[model samples]
Target: MSLKPNIVLVAALALSVAGCGKKEVDTLPPAPGPAPIQSQNQGSQTRIVPGSQADFSNRMAGLDTIYFDTDQFDIDDEDAVALRRQAEWLRQYPAKRARIEGYTDERGTREYNLALGERRATAARNYLVSLGIAENRLTVISYGKERPAVLDSTEAAWARNRRAVTLTID
Candidate 1:
């Protein structure tokens, strides 16, 4: 009958309704199954089965690796073409991140090769960043002469080894 009682009723209704916005989660269903067991080694990686997206992407667009001249870290016109495609791919899949890995031929000292590898990787990363890719989504690493694409010391082998590879993150 009084306005004060109506106001109190409205306030009580509001208090009741305020908490209804967030529906409580149902009791979770039973586990699908026990988690798969792993070997004792238990590497740092969480996934035992790696993503095949990189392979699929590589098959679709050959933008995985860019070759470099001996003792050079500059991205050539040919490599630029691939890099542009890479930038496009990254743009399309904003969720996908990448790691630019630099590798050098086994010609220089370890220290020298490491420095060269770093420069090579950084060059690739910078080029991708210039193409409007978020810098935070990309990382650079140097493998030096440790992980060669080709093992032999021949000119052709060295040529294949001197390169930067873009590995996609899951």
Candidate 2:
């Protein structure tokens, strides 16, 4: 057999394989604009623009960070309560989207910490979904040991470092 025929056959096979897997995507309705915010600045109303980082931060203060124990990815009761509040905030702003960033302490290998961080972020995201937040509105990223919240080597710093931070996004 000539090589030309083999080339054509291989090309056809390649084309067929390339199109074999197709994914069906879920669609969401248009998100409503941010609700107006009332402020006392000069006795005039202001807007934070819901779904924006500012809005999420403003509404999620003191509840945006979820800490984990050493070498653990589980969400404890305290974190669960915080996550519940975060979920409620998400529910109030249906159009808002969030990014869950996971981090680790400075004691683990980069690879290991990366995986652990991913688990942390995923756990937070899953908890939010279970609380009725739309799954599609959340995304996850892991900083692992690369981005420590505190640079100190103290246990308290490490505790703060091992956390997942939920940030609002457009």
Candidate No. with top TM-score? 2
For residues 70-155, write the lDDT of model 2, one tens digit per residue. 99999999999889988988888798888999999999799999999999999999999999998999999999999888899999
After superposition, candidate 2 runs with Cα above 4 Å error: 1-47
Listed per candidate, the RMSD to the true structure in angstroms reads 18.5, 17.1
Q: Residue pairs in steric clash, candidate 1? A: none
TM-score of each: 0.67, 0.71
- What lDDT would each prediction earn against the true structure? 0.83, 0.88
User: What lDDT score goes with residue 61 in model 1?
Assistant: 68
Model 1 scores a C-alpha lDDT of 0.83
